[model samples]
Target: MTDFSGLQQLTSLIRNIEAQMEGAKLMILTHEHREEIARHMVEGLVGPSREHKVRIETSSGEYMNQLAILEIGGNKYTFSKDHQGMFISEINYYTCRITPNSHGILVYHQDYPGVIHDVSRVLAENKINISSMNVSREQKGKSALLVSLTDEEIPQSLLSRLQQLPQVQQVLSLQ
Candidate 1:
């Protein structure tokens, strides 16, 4: 997976949904440790200021999949300045179930009121169990939610429904 195809595969995933997320916070990362390369790409995309939003370039497997663990977004500047390593770990959901390429994270933003509830309900309605969840918001009228789950690809209809929500800005699944 360390071949050039691996890099192109991830890049294509991101580029496919980048424009839908104007003003949405982004946390660009990799399963490969390429700080200089990641930084160059992010700077070109997210801009140089890096104010309210952030981009965290951390190390992970250069070849296979990675745990869904991720640092918060707004603190990237503090992280760059403080120099104190802030490591938060998340347990992979399907530790015993599926292989690496099968698990991934789900990201989306929906109407603040009952968004999380709606997501959980949707998953339950579809028999998708939520093993771990992390939801946060930047300010009034802005939010980000990430759910790392096991096997079973979320169906197109469900994903489209989430994307059609009134206040939902972006919906993307990365594996």
Candidate 2:
């Protein structure tokens, strides 16, 4: 992603902090080698001022991967960078894939055959077009997450249907 796109993506992740979060604490979790880039990301997200409601910190994490975890809105989200670019690596500790795509659906479900088809069918039935998709699984038949980029917002009824799926554990729509 371009710098602008990266900033836009970071803004989406931190929008809640700027809009409704009060007395927020943002933890930048990464390896020592990534402190510089992590700090730059923190500044981009919360700005340079110390008076904001967000408390920023850059702490050493366990690994050397180009990943950063943010604690905001009572949740922890992990974003990682790779050759493909920056995307959400996990949410609330669940392994998943999501980019700063700005609009998409995040589905946490059991790793099972046809889950992807089922999700696509639901969206297709509702006339929602999938622009892209990213799926990550911890193991076979175990916890998994699918992030689907769409052209439009997911309706509440469609979202409810997705939540009702037998393999689905959670459904989150991001815009």
Off by over 4 Å in 1: 1-105
- Local accuracy of candidate 1 as per-residue lDDT tens digits, 1-175: 1222222333333333344334433333344445543443344334446543433445443423331222232121111101221212221221212112333345556437777777667778888666656655455565554554545667767777767666667666643
TM-score per model over all chains: 0.43, 0.67
Q: What is the lDDT of residue 160 in candidate 1?
A: 78
How far off is residue 165 in model 2, in Å? 1.4
Candidate 1 least-lDDT 10 residues: 74-83
Candidate 2 per-residue lDDT, tens place, 68-122, comes to 6666667677767667777667666766556664566788899999999999999
Best by lDDT: 2
Q: What's each prediction's clash count?
A: 1, 0
Q: List per-candidate RMSD values in Å.
A: 10.9, 4.5
> CA lDDT, every prediction?
0.43, 0.69
